[model samples]
Target: MRTLLSNIKVQVNPKIYIKDPETSVLGRKIIQESIILIDEIGFDSFTFKKLGDRIGSNESSVYRYFENKHKLLVYLSSWYWSWMEYRIVFATANIADPSEKLRKAITLVTEKIEDDATTDYIDESVLNRIIIAEFTKTFLTKEVDLENKEGFFLIYKRVVNRIVDIITEISPDFPFPKSFASGIVEGSLHQHFIKDHFKTITDCNDDVSPTDFYLHLATFITKQP
Candidate 1:
């Protein structure tokens, strides 16, 4: 079976290759089902057996892909960044303007969170906690180095740098440093995930969308005293 898996053609065109295509596809399906379960049952109650049942597989079969829950959560966490990269890149690829690219970046980042289906199955408070504890914090580890061109944050960083390069083309006086700009974007998404809290605890309006929050931030940054 390992040999057969090895011989299988993953990408018809060698230019569009994926490492361990069969395993990766299976891993993706597992992660998706896991998210659904995590939403329905809450992360504390979600289990591999439940995930396997949802995917029409036995628990051992699930184990063949993910050794345990921790490993599975890592993949799921990684997928969030990966998916974010895909969305931002697709949204901004055609635009030649740096500011417009930034706008699209903010839009995609915010809308992605607001549009998340997990909101339906999971409580907002619990989901926010999971995202903050797991997904948001996932960005800070030494694993940042493990992120190649494949992962979301790194790819997103590249996109930001490219935009910064363009902004530098337009105005060197602009104070939007690359790392700072990326942080602003990250913080924007982070804030959006906790918008309800922001409204309750701070001066924010209830109608604030991710894009609106980002636009306000962008304006503030560009208008610094």
Candidate 2:
């Protein structure tokens, strides 16, 4: 699976960038450095000038690919989810049981991520950190509705929809698969965050993980054995 996925491109929304970062060496370098920089100093403190210094490229060069940091973030988030969508599809492809399929999908979303060696430019492990820490900022803006209409979050919505489909398959009578799916995806990030920062609040830790909690919820809510 890793070998097959290595050849696949994690496509992002073209609207998210002026030039596709995956298209050129310089563009890829911008993405590679930006992920490291954002994870190090945080998204709020991240800037194109700082990125330029890190990549040894002019500030305007960064702008050629991305109009602003917000779009760049959206691009990164889209790429991450697109990669995840591919993974979920591959992981759940041959399972005969909906329960097991849902478990795999849930684990994919909720567990600690590892970097994929396939995409030499982007780091999934650090990108997961950025997603966990800063993904919400992408849609917390006034233009979110407009962006949504423009399909800036299509891949994210699709990933959640896959979970929703799996949940619905497990229990056709389930009352709120969409809500449950969105909650699991978003809430897992919250749990992981608090598990690191506010350890007193979340049960996720070294022994327990966000995946275990959500998988339990899936069984309990779906009444699956």
Candidate 3:
């Protein structure tokens, strides 16, 4: 994975940003600090003004990169999905067993994140928390149709598609490869949310890790008739 991260720059949808945030120092700061601010205060309470202050830039400067906070959220969500897909590819590259590949993918998606020093600008651990907490806000809007048409969610769809291909390889006769793959991704995220905020909503035991639960769920779904 370290080799993959050596020179990696996750490309996000251009439509989500007013300008490419990866192109300039201030732009990168806006992205890096915005992720931290959003994770600290969440989407509803987060503002570009607040993010500007955190990064020692004004709101207008930040606005040059993103049209609004919503666009920033979309950009972050796209970046997260791209990064996750990279991890999936790197982790599964050497393994020939489809089941093992699936298990590795599931574990990567469900397990806790730690900041990678290789990507010094972004704290992936904090970004993962933001994804678990507020990723739905990226698409659960009236403009979803327009955004979908603009390919705002392409990285996410690509991630799901990659997993679906893996599932098809493992179980060629599986009837709902896309459905099961998407369910594993979303269900793992929601289960984490439930465990964190509404404990009673989930049946996961105190002893069971999220990785274990998701791996079991993925295996069961893929093997089912």
Candidate 4:
């Protein structure tokens, strides 16, 4: 599975960038180093100038691939979702039970992300940190509606829809599969964030595993009401 995934290229939305970052060595450096820098500092403080300094390139070179940091963020977020969808497909393949499939999906979303060597350029663990820490900024802006119309959120929507399909298969009468899917994904991220930064706000302590909490939520939500 790792070998198969290594050969796969997760495509980002073309509209999010000025040039395809994966096509050039310098462009890929911008992406690889930006993830590291953003994780080290944050999205608000990160800039193409800082990125150029880190990658030993000029600011204009980075700008060639991305118009600005926001577009780069959207590109990174889209890439992460695309990679996650790939993982879900590979992990749940050949599974005959919807309940088991749902469980696997929940675990995949909630569990701690380890570094995936399959993707040599982009570090999955660091990218996961960025997604958890700063991904909402990609769409929470005033331009989100316009971007939505442009299909900027397609990969994320596709991931949620994929899980929703499994959910509806498990409980055909489920009325809020989409809500449940989105909630589980976003909720898992929230719980992790809370656990890391604001422990008082959530019950996600050392004894209470996020995987268990999310699996319980999925079971309860899918049960006949």
Candidate 5:
């Protein structure tokens, strides 16, 4: 109970709960704190024991809420993707013009990627690389059997398909398939995640930010014949 309240204190405002907040249900608090601690410390360093310690609980107590660290990470990842999907859906909903929708899609996604608050959870650079690698392995592979891929890939698949839909709408006249155009968008997005590495292999001026790269790419895609 002590641990649960401790976590809530960190993640949520105390004014919301008036009395006996410290003795609240354990399950809600553990997950809440797990998320908070993970965001503060990051996945690589975040452990059940560490979380428990921070929350004034034991490792065993933490396990009662999450079976393991991987389980917690899966939950966190799902949470993030859910937020991503919501924003993507909301951003594209009203835009009837395919070109505008495509640009908005790119802009919204890039903004999410560049969001500074997210840095509290994980190093954006590392997080982007991990996301891209997982996306490629789970959704971008030659394997068509969705059942064969891990469950984590499902969220990525949905996001990619959303992008594909927008691309198809914008480039109905383009020669390539929908998936091919989607792949281009996905590849460019992934590249923005780790654009720093590209500088080592090729010349990138110091002034070139990921947003700059994305704008150029967006313009190029918009002007596609």
Candidate 6:
């Protein structure tokens, strides 16, 4: 998989950024530091000026890459999902059994993430935390419909549909592939967050991960008549 992942480029929608962050050093720093800063302080508290101070660059420099923090969050979310889709494709590529492939896909989306050393500037693990905590802010707005039309969420939708394809392959007779796939992807994030903070509400804990729960559901869902 390393060979496949080695050549991978995480492409975010062009509408999400004024300039591609991967093209320049300052842009990369803006992305790298913004992830750490947003993770350190919640999105409600994050500001370009504060990020500028953190990176020793003026706020204008940050704006060169993104129009606002919200767009930056979307960009990060897009990149993370694009990266994840890359992993899902490779991880499930050789599996002959539909159930095993479905389980592998479930595990990739639900399990805790670790930093990918190959991507030097982006810490995917940190990005995953941001996605879990702040991703809703990107679309939970009045402008979501317009932005969705502009395809800001295309990468994320593609990730969900990839799982939907696998679900259909396994459960040709099953209904609700889109809803089921989306629930597994987005629901896992909720499970992980609740397990850490709202502990009593979730069965996921130290020994039992969101991955374990979703794997069981994926297996059960595939067997449906």
User: lDDT of all the models against the reference?
Assistant: 0.54, 0.93, 0.87, 0.89, 0.54, 0.91
Tens-digit lDDT track of model 2 for 161-219: 99999888888888889999999999999999999999998889999999999999988
Point out the higher-scoring one by TM-score: 3 or 6: 6
lDDT per residue as tens, model 1, 152-221: 3453455456546644644567666675567655665566555655466444355656667666666544
Model 6 lDDT tens row, 1-225: 867687878778898999999999999999999999999998999999999999998999998899998999999999899999999998998999888889999999999999988898989899999999998888999999999999999988998999999999988878789999999999999998999899999999999999999998877776776
Off-target runs (Cα >4 Å) in candidate 2 are none
Tell me the lDDT of candidate 6: 0.91
TM values, all candidates = 0.62, 0.98, 0.95, 0.97, 0.61, 0.98
lDDT of 2 at 88: 95
Model 5 bad stretches (over 4 Å) = 1-32, 39-42, 112-150, 173-207
RMSD of each: 8.5, 1.1, 1.5, 1.2, 9.3, 0.9
Cα deviation at 63, candidate 4, in Å, is 0.7
Q: What TM-score should be assigned to candidate 2?
A: 0.98
Candidate 4, residues 108-152, lDDT tens digits: the string is 888889889977788989999999899889889999999999999
**Predicted candidate 3 versus true structure: per-residue lDDT over 1-225, tens digit per residue:** 876775888989888998999899998888898888888888999998888789887889998988888899999999999999998999999999888899988888888888877887889999999999999999999999999999999999999998899899988888888998888888888888888788887865467767788787776755655
Clashes of 2: 0
- Return the top candidate by lDDT: 2
- TM-score-better candidate, 1 vs 6: 6
In angstroms, give how far residue 45 of model 2 lies from its true place. Answer: 0.9
lDDT rank order:
2, 6, 4, 3, 5, 1
Regions of candidate 4 where Cα sits further than 4 Å from its true position: none
Instruction: Please write out the lDDT profile of model 5 over residues 25-79, one tens digit for every residue.
Output: 6655665676566556656687878877877878887665555665455444444
Prediction 2 global C-alpha lDDT: 0.93
